[model samples]
Target: MASDTDFYSILGVSRDAGKDEIQRAYRKLAREYHPDVNKDPAAEERFKQISEAYDVLRDPKQRERYDAFGPDFRRVPPDMDPADYARARAGAERRTSSRGDPWGGGTGTWEEWPEGVRFSSGSAEGIDLDDLLGGIFGGRGRRGGPIPGSDQEVEIELSVEDAYHGGSRSLTVEGAGGTRTLNVKIPPGVVNGQRIRLGGQGAQGLGGGAAGDLYLIVRIADHPRYRLDGRDIHVDLPLAAWEGALGASVEITTPGGPATVKVPKGTSTGRQLRLRGRGLPNPKGRPGDLYADVKLMVPHRLTREEERLFEELAGTSKFDPRRRR
Candidate 1:
């Protein structure tokens, strides 16, 4: 049967996607749309759609039934046939008397049949007793039980240094219970795309169901002086042309503090000075190394004396940078 509510689209998976693909899609979307994590007005509705899709697609039997009956699978029997429904409909119409009374409220069909008599409608719109009882007893109804709370995911922006060192921070969210503040302890070495889960911080549950969790996705802000690659740290070390020709020692800022590094003679732009174990620390491995890349610069505007010195060097120096030796 054709379906309007496509589970594949809800979870962002292809129609022929495998089980793992569907699960991964759900997890990724769950982190973004979970009510506690995302405070946007539409997040809750989006989360519900994905959750409902996941609930059915994750189950083998439910998935098969859903594939066959669309969203109405839950309300219709899996093994029911079209001919069976036709027969049931015909039987209900046959049970209806010429009179219009349903339960013999008037001096109608039931009275003529004596006591303990019941009647059905006389057409396709007639009510089938089995269907009515099944709906009332939750045999194949859409809504039948308690529902768990929705999970939430939100972004928490942090500085590059803050991610390296870790610290305490605060966050405020407009939850189902209203605006609330939470104090968060950031773990050391936390990196971009990492998530911090806070349990019981999601949407309120229904019918005594358990509340969901909240996830904080880390987004590290850019830095003017530093660039990070995994556990590695990189910084530009500016130098004059003369410094590149005749080595010198210079002080540079690192995450730990200021430190002096020797600039080897003949250093060129893009040359890196490695400082072992000075980058971000990791719990599972050794700390990353820091690299100071050379950045050669010249005076924006030369002074008279500096211009004279440069003219003299141009006349006397034997170096021919563009010529092949």
Candidate 2:
């Protein structure tokens, strides 16, 4: 709040800018000024400025406060009345020096910010400054003493086969105190990016507050033979040229197990053969279907007899791939 530099000016956006506009400005500035991408020594400082600006503007409540009273918006609690904020601002002004701020942390008063280091958290835009402030001033400002610990998020990766069948797995969740292990039951037919909630498994709360929940974000690992889309599964079914042209019973492998799919005569590449109820099963609803995608394979090195037979077929058959039928 005490700084002469305006955050809106730093992000190159207007004071009345919308959230999307603010975010766009932040992204453009961040990419241009990021130290990893930009070699200019000043770029690091500019990047921090944009990041700090975005962190405030992105949060609705925070943006409201920032709009009302520049950086010192943080000096006054969100729930405090405008009259109380003025009084607190006066009190903070009297308590701190010209160099100090009441809204900041680390070697500064509550209305100020430390140089060079805005936020170091590795989250979406780095640390949540509001959460950090809440944690800091919770004892004085909050009525309930301390809120429940923040929910923790962790990604759990599963193989295609494991995801198809579903099983039990163990994982380590990082907490404020340290790391703890938990047993997770991967529900059958859980889709990618789906979250599984674990109750009361987050960080320990302060002042006897209730612990928070843990969320496991499901991430399915890439499989060599299988491609999944929602409840449907696609597997490439390799067939010889003759089998594709003349039809044959071909044995193909599915995520569950190996099965046989009959290739109809005149089957073409990219042909999909649906096998009902052969994909992942959903406990809550209907099971998924599996589709075998045909992939025709021609012999790379043919014997003399095979070449002669192909030559004879070429002379006898009237098949034109390029001609429209």
lDDT, candidate 1, 1-325, per-residue tens: 1134788888878867788988899889977976656879988677667766876788888787777555555544435553443444444344444444344334332221211223343443444443433332232222333334666767799887898889999998777788878898898887655657787787766545456677787777779998876567889999999998899999999877888879999898989999899888787679888899999999999999999999999999998888986
lDDT of each: 0.70, 0.69
Model 1, position 73, has a per-residue lDDT of 55
- Which ranges of candidate 2 are over 4 A from the true structure? 1-146
Candidates' TM-scores?
Answer: 0.55, 0.58
Candidate 2 Cα lDDT to native: 0.69
| Residues forming the 10-long window of minimal summed lDDT in candidate 1 | 108-117
RMSD of each: 11.5, 11.7
lDDT score at residue 48, model 2, on the 0-100 scale: 55
lDDT of 2 at 95: 38
**Number of clashes recorded per candidate:** 6, 9
